[model samples]
Target: MNEMGKTDTVVQPQSSLLELKKMFFLYLPVCIGGYIVFRVLIVLPLWFSSSTEQLSVLRIIFIILGVGALAVVVLGAVRAPRWVEKPIHVHYRHWAPAFFATLVILGSIGGHLVASAKINSNLALEKVKAHFEKETAEYKMGRNAQ
Candidate 1:
């Protein structure tokens, strides 16, 4: 107590907290973008290119990176209101960045899914055709020799 009823308090340095928050707000988008690239572009390709024996390990790494990136982006978005300032005029400009990023993310995932499905379907069709051809060849060879 310092005065008749007021409590005494020590002065606190606000610069550190202010600086940390400033850094976070400034680099928030960059961090999210980098993580997205690492997760989708780099980690995913590495996982897909890995051999069967090493696939599991790479898969785990991909999953971890993906989850971490998602978490970071989500957290940043959730906390955006804390640091982001809105303009006096209403416009689509505010939402454009997030919208485009989301569009790219969805497009990439959808493209990957469709491409993988097509490749697998083609592989299966090739297998079926090969099986039929092998059966016909074996039958013809046996009959001709007899």
Candidate 2:
């Protein structure tokens, strides 16, 4: 009731539960697509490199980009509008999902880095060995023909 003895009518914005659910649904596919692209295009190529110097350069780049993306997400969450902010009472619980999502993203990026570095290092070593063997064989043949 109002101070003037009139009923106070408060208008609240309608909750968009359906919209929220749709947004989450849309996010899943985008995340999956990003994961696939990163794995196939970026990670795989870096992993298969024949030069350790090149792989190291790539590793640094990937690490920087991954960290930058995480920072952006954290900053965006912190600066979210007041209307989207959860009550202090439920803040921890509300943040759990975001925390888990960030962990997954970071973990995947780390995994890609580790896997690519290992594969690239191995590939580079093998290439060096092959080149040495080829050069040795050619030297022996030249000596025999002289």
Q: Which has the greatest lDDT? A: 2
The lDDT values for all models are 0.52, 0.61
Worst 10-residue lDDT window, candidate 1:
87-96
Best by TM-score: 2
lDDT tens readout by residue for model 1, 1-146:
86588887886545656655655565566557745653464334334543433444444554554455455556546645423343211123333344445434553454344435545565788899999999999999999999
| Model 1 TM-score, 2 decimals | 0.42
Q: lDDT of candidate 2 vs native?
A: 0.61
For candidate 2, lDDT tens digit of each residue in 22-49?
Answer: 5566556656755565455444544465
Q: Candidate 1 — which pairs collide?
A: none
Model 2 segments more than 4 A misplaced:
1-17, 46-48, 82-108, 119-146
TM-score of each: 0.42, 0.47
Lowest lDDT 10-residue stretch of candidate 2: 87-96
